[model samples]
Target chain A: MGIIAAIDLGGTAIKGALFDGTGPLTKKNHPTEAKKGYGHVLQNIDQLIQRMADNKGIKVDEIRSVGVGVPAFMAEQGRRVVLAPNLGWSDVDFASDLAEQMQKPVFCNNDANLAALGEHWQGNGKDIENLLMVTIGTGIGSGLILNGELYQGKSGMAVEVGHMVIMAEGSHRCSCGRQGCVEALTAAPAIVREAKKLMDVPTDCLPDVNITEAKQVYQAAASGDKRALQVVEKAAYFLGVALANILNFYELDVIIIGGGVAQAGDILLNPLRRTVARETVFFQRRPTEILPGMLGNDAGVFGAARWAALGEAKKRG
Target chain B: MGIIAAIDLGGTAIKGALFDGTGPLTKKNHPTEAKKGYGHVLQNIDQLIQRMADNKGIKVDEIRSVGVGVPAFMAEQGRRVVLAPNLGWSDVDFASDLAEQMQKPVFCNNDANLAALGEHWQGNGKDIENLLMVTIGTGIGSGLILNGELYQGKSGMAVEVGHMVIMAEGSHRCSCGRQGCVEALTAAPAIVREAKKLMDVPTDCLPDVNITEAKQVYQAAASGDKRALQVVEKAAYFLGVALANILNFYELDVIIIGGGVAQAGDILLNPLRRTVARETVFFQRRPTEILPGMLGNDAGVFGAARWAALGEAKKRG
Candidate 1:
């Protein structure tokens, strides 16, 4: 039972952490420099893990294994990153490459899935046996923990709730070429797109600040800007419908909302909760508790470390 | 283990079967007489089970236990029929009541759930570890078998794919008081409703015979009736969308279509399959096999028998 190292590779940065079962010992971050290509990103991850190990005063040999969570689909039993639109990566043997360079066994999974495991292991969903975590950021992503285990479906593609169509004939188009998907309606980019539409319209209800991001829209809504309030309400309504659908399908113990858009807190959650209550088919019989995720951006790293530790234990068994 | 008895209580009749692990030894059917009240249905079920055992040349004492599948929600760990709109039953302790009268333990669960288990154990889903069975009848109902077990959500309410809203803000109203639910659009009653709407219009394409039943609509469609084809196509489209949503959420290995409407066979399945292929998120990567349920009406009885046998084995353990 040695220390575990974890890396969460995001579009902008690679976050690294060292853990020894109790909790994270040290954390560090390095620029992903994704645009510079996969080689540079791999090197950065290598350095990031080394720095995290050094910061924790641990030897490389003392670290049992490393787990990486990437914003991409993992293939070949998590030895490869098959696709990552954000990082422009495809079919990269990330786990094997990292293992070769770092001299430790490596495992990898979709970042969202790890976030769910992290939440179930030690965060908001610690006591939950089954849970769904939906992250509403640049694009919506979800992870499912079912029957006390992370359910990856038949091909590690389960819980793609974000692409579920809320509006069958919706006007908005998703990046996946689908129309009316939940991501198309309520992701951070969707909210920003809606707010930009409002900005172009002639209205005295416009916010004073330049509304460019989803956060600005939330801030304006909090300050009672009419246009911003309308935009947020629309996104919240769609998000609620999607959540209600998930609740109906999974009947999970709890649902954790995380990522950028969820930071609006009560302003977003209140309306979403109301919609879920109204939209859920048997709400009285199957009430689901919806809450905010506790670990925030660090959930992926914690989950990766936990996954690595679990994998190591399984190997021992 | 002794012989096992299973009863599938439908609105019209109670189907009973006796099994000795290998297969059913005898089968019998009795009028449910549901309109006479829950008491009459229970009495009829008892008589049916007695008849099944007697026909098999076995004494009631030889039967280890009875399992009942009802068109209702099983509550209190498969001991009570929480709700059955067709049977006009609510909160009936079906298991305990039957156990007391029959002098043997009795277990109960939703008929659809049993059908799924039956399919998994002996039918099309025998080889499947994760599967979804959607029964399209007067109303649509669904069952889920996940990780090789029946997945009843927190309170036996998971896989209510019937009430999943396929068309948000849709004009069709479901029996559950929801609009645009898959059941609202694709159930037998819904198809009949749509056909009637077309019949009300003055069109040369109208069927010569009155389309009062879903069967009539299918017959007309098979005979190249234009209006009926439109209605069936519309229902198939929505049903496809709902199935696609289920596939995306669960990433199940296979989907089995059962019940009355599925009797339309390829006329309904061909269009539905095409729509599902088009609507699913990653159909290319995760190809889900869609097929018809093999055991047909016998699935419920087989499922109930299997469930009882499993319960008896667990008790022995």
Candidate 2:
């Protein structure tokens, strides 16, 4: 059984897992510190892989391939990042650069796309063929899987469901320079922004809620706070509308909601399902199933490993 | 060496054409008079095919297959019309009845979808692989071809681009009960409706102008009529916004404009292109090539023929 190394590359940290054809056997984590520059991050990936290989008492050749899940639009084969705003990079040739240092084949794609793939392959949507895995963290993102294959549109930027305009002249401003996008109103900061505007809540109200994270809005909503509930409901409506638009557009069988916001569960799911059901035009038939992510935080790593294994399979085929 | 029969089933008339397995050779036109009942219409089709086959000294089987394009949603191997508001049909087994009468395998699909496929197979989009054929007629209809294959979504209702809501609180009401659909604002009647709303258009000022056809407005605009041009520009802007939304969503390579309103040509195309370029997010890198449809009115007949030919190929395969 060949070994596949999966890496979830983020701005603050890099998590690596070693899988022997079946599942993870050992894992490692390291700080990314993206502001330090691309070279430093690349160096960190190289050192982490070396340490993992040494711990298993195996040579570099013993590993079959390595897969990476990044937060960016991959043009094709995940060789270069077209534009990753979080990483503060443009057109970085991470695939070739990493292969040169690690001396192994590397497969890469957008982290959200990979998470979707991970969920489709090994999580809730295992029995389903067509679905979308939406990741809602600080920003909103999605990976579309159609006809049992990843639907990367022309130029590889197909499923921008997050930026899909929900309101024509909506008040919220999305980071992508578009107004009325679902992400503009539903993302983490948007929730906090809405909370601050709803009440003259002190700075301590926010700090006490999360201290270090923005996901606490869900917690407040879960705690039965009226303002927080309204904020979450607003996000749910936009998400539901966006999902309804998606359901209207694609006729998808299921949509798996992931990311930090999904932790609120019923606080978000009930309204979302009702809104989507009400908003959808063709409600006579089966409605799109909304489910929680089964893979959780490990989804990106698992998806990356799946990407590597599939690449190896394709090469042999 | 073989001839194929193509039929366009309309509420008012039934249009038929004979092709020598390549292009149209002879045409036969007759009234559908569907209110005369289903059996009469079936008999009409039988007589039409018999007359054409006898005139050419050919057996019906030598024609390969018969294709019927209906203005409705067809499914379950074209054995039924899933829904068609215009024809007042619901789950009617039109295809099977037609195939049984003709004693040959028959294929059926929505007329607009077939038109796009026809354009892709032999008309304007012949050279382009990823194309979106948008027809601006009685209603806005679209047929999408992606990666060289016709993309029908999970429930076979994909590519209903006309119903895509462009305006949230839009002033116009669509035929589908949706508010602010592109079809409600830019279709032929919509263009005419806007022309009627223009203030102080003395009845004699633009003699060619009327509130029935888009061509009247085009003629008026050509004669340097300000009111006519304004209406045309408004319709064109809405169309451009809709196209921009589609491009932002799908990243299609080519968009073929067809149907009655498309006759305005450059008057509509020029403003549409400018608006789309301005509204689209990735306008610089991913430019969608907008072009005029080549098949004109014959697109429906040819598309019907192609739809029929697919069944013929499958039987022989």
Candidate 3:
């Protein structure tokens, strides 16, 4: 039994968890000033992993491997971030560098993909073989598990479901600079943007409340606010449209919705179910189940641990 | 070496070919008269197979398997045609019925899918894995071969690339009753319709010309007719759009273009390449090689033979 360090690299904070052969032993979080240069963040991760390992009474040599989750497309063979729009980094050899510093086998993958794997290993998708984990945060992201394996396709960019065009000629600019991306319209920020357009919202109720906050939009919708409800429904429509298209393409059994905006619960799910049912071509054949994510915020950390476990298994084999 | 009986079931005729392990020993064609009854067609296939095998000096017992192809979605288990809009057949269990009479293992699949598989086995895709074979004929149809295996999704409706929406709001009625289907605008008939509306060609100039016949459009386009060229280019645009989308989803190495319309060669391919270059989201990342199919009219027959071979292998394993 060896310890493995799992790192969830977010924009604001770098979350790390140390796991002994079985489960997590300790967790740590530190602010990531990405603008300070990439080198600084790299050093920060190395130090954090070491500190976590030390706290757990494990030596650096005792740790079998390290799993790092980043926000981007990871190449299948190289395990490098091919394109990460969020980090403003390109062609970064993350795995090799992380391995060099940590002095162990390092495995890197898309954060959402690792999250899906995490959920598959210990969360709601534990019993399911074919599952789609749709994360609804500031941006909509998805990770697909097809036929009991992570289908990364030829280039490991196969499951870029968020970039898929849900609505043709949709009037929204996605973070990826593409139009009609499911992420552009269905994400938390997009929901808030839609809710802010209501002329009567400010005067009627919550006069000084900011519309940019996704939770405010959810609260207003929960209070029977017409504009807020429409905004949430529209977001759900796009999400459902994308989910339906994916269902038709891959034909998965269930879609687990996670992330911050998924907190809206029934308000988001009801409209999404309606839109998915109406838009899907094979609605009559079999209906896809939409369930809330069970792993919550620790999904990425759990997934990172799962990734390390799998890597250890592969190495042992 | 065992002889294999292959059947290519078309709307007008049933083409039968007998293969002695590698190449065709003898070929025979007969009127299908599908509108009459399913039993009549089945009997015709039986007689046709017998005649071909006899001509090749092969005993009925020496024949390994009978492979049949249809213009519809084959069920996951390859037992029946789940849906064939053109043939107006649903859940037709041709396998059990044909197997009972032949007293041998029988295999059947979608003609387009078989064509793709046939190409993969002996034609253009022989050396390549992870290919998308698109047949541009009466309607656009595709078959995906991923990781050296035919990807038949959950409901055996995997590579339905033609039905994918190209123009979210293109004013066209797809044969599937869906609007904005790539097939609706890019199919051979659609090209001819656009050509006829744009050009005034004399009957003598293009003999035996019809909007439904892809050859007519190719003829006009080849003769330097401006309108015909425009129509072909338009179709190529939509076709390229769908292909690019597929490329984004699956980073395939090659896309083998087949079917009757693909006979036009560069008249369709040149524009498709250019359009795919401009439209594909991942155009800057993974580069895909597109080429015309080599199997031509014999693709289905060869595919049937290959399918039979696969079935035998599976049974042995």
Candidate 4:
């Protein structure tokens, strides 16, 4: 085994890590400046990889491969990024470009999927055969590990749990132009949106803190603010319902929740667990454990590195 | 290849068939008399298998194995029926009992799962690698075939799509004590229930036909009854949402809808297709085909036989 460079491309920053089979040797980050366009982002990634290799005193040839996790819909063969709304990309062959530039093999996949894979490789889902990792942040993102392998559907678009409809005639609108989706109900933006509605209502139980962001709402709820608690409860309810739906549909061993909103801790987890237990089709018959993802933001980089290693191993075989 | 007996157990009837690799050699049915309890149902199944073997002039020794499909939560190895509400069964070792009685190796699984396997093996899903088969009958039942095999989760209870909650605060109550599950909104019983509600609303748009069954509602809707159309539209919307959710989560090649309500043909399929197309997260990027199941009720028996054959082959290997 040799060093592998892993990069996780995001809207704000690009996270990079150097790994050698066992674990990460070093990790670093650089501003994405996505506003500067895809070419700039690619150049930035190339520079970051070079910097990591130099810092580790490892020649470029010593690195077995490079892995990339991007916030995009990857093609089935992982040859290209089919779509990335935030990156403003479509059908970009990032893998080929990076591989050509670095003069090494490179593998790429959906960022969320990489995170789930990371969790499975070295985080919370290790030793678990089947699991679903859902990251609840600006939007809900999920990665499914079924039968100990990544389960990307026919078009490499499986595990879009956020856009799953939780309400048939729901009022909340998702950015995907759909209503009552899990994302529309439980995403950070949705929580903040609900808090904004509650702030206008005259209530003695309102938190003294000004509600501007989802974190503030969580803070207020943690402090026993009734209005904030209601908002959290509502979001937790929908999240729980969505989770129960997943449990019923997949029957996995564990469900790992990650991202910013999941940081609400017990405020979200307790209620979510309760709702999931209450709403699950047959709780007595089929029980699924729900837990928080252990790898935090580094999950993507770790997963990307592992993906590259696996791809290289497969190629060698 | 030796003859294999496949049995699909329903509340009122037990459908049986004999298969020898190529296709089902013969098919027959017998009264389940489930009201007479588990013993009677078992006897019925035994008698049915004996009758089929006799009709084919095959001795019991010529039958390689037996397969039974039941509406229950099957154990991981398909040894027992853990819980089947309709059959009033819990932790029943139906496979062992039947195998002992018939002196043949027996395999068991959920009826819907078998139907999905059947569809994949010989029905509409033939040659397809990943698919979901949803039977929209009195109660909605679904089976998922992922990566060309049945996807039974941790405890052999995966792919219970019918119990997936589609509404967070929905008024419709499912028999499983959940609110607004796919079954509660789209099952045949639910359609009939919604039609009855519309009939009492005092509208000239209501069809003159008695709204006692789901079939009547579909017929009225087909005949241009406005009230009936509205009910069907609502059910179709919910069904479409549920299907979309499955698509987003599983990312399958196709979704095959079967059973009584699916018989509504274009009245239901047309709207469902449109809704799925419109409400899907990224329609242009990922398109999933939705079609009606071809094997119909016989899908279960066919699948059961195939499952037994596969199990025997695996054992021999």
Please provide TM-scores, in order, for all candidate models, with all chains considered together: 0.92, 0.89, 0.90, 0.93
Model 2 Cα interface RMS deviation (Å):
2.9
Clashing pairs in 3: none
lDDT of 4 by residue, B1-317 (tens): 58899999987889999999799988999998888988888888989988898998987678889988898877665677878888888988888888888888898889999999999999999999889998998888888888899877666764777888888689988888889988999898888888887766544545254677898888888878887888888888888888887777666788998888888888888888898888775734557798998998899998899889888988899
Weakest 10 consecutive residues of candidate 3 chain A by summed lDDT: A199-208
Name the candidate that leads on TM-score: 4
Per-candidate DockQ vs. reference: 0.52, 0.33, 0.32, 0.65
Residue A270, candidate 1: Cα error in Å is 1.1
Best candidate, lDDT: 4
Candidate 2 lDDT, A124-185, residue by residue in tens: 87878889999988888798888887777766664777776655556776777656677887
**Among the candidates, what TM-score does chain A have in each?**
0.94, 0.93, 0.94, 0.95
lDDT of each: 0.82, 0.77, 0.78, 0.85
In model 4 chain B, which range of ten residues has the least summed lDDT?
Answer: B201-210
Better of 1 and 4 by lDDT: 4
Which candidate, 1 or 3, would have the higher DockQ against the true structure? Answer: 1
Return the candidate ranking by TM-score, descending: 4, 1, 3, 2
Which of the CAPRI classes, incorrect, acceptable, medium or high, describes model 2? Answer: acceptable
**Model 1 C-alpha lDDT per residue in residues A13-46, reported as the tens digit of each score:** 8999888878989999999999998778878888
Sort order, lDDT high to low: 4, 1, 3, 2
Q: Where does candidate 2 stray beyond 4 Å?
A: A51-61, A169-173, A194-216, A225-230, A248-251, A283-285, B47-63, B169-173, B193-212, B221-234, B248-251, B279-286
Candidate 1 Cα misplacement greater than 4 A, ranges? A52-62, A197-205, A281-286, B53-58, B198-206, B281-284
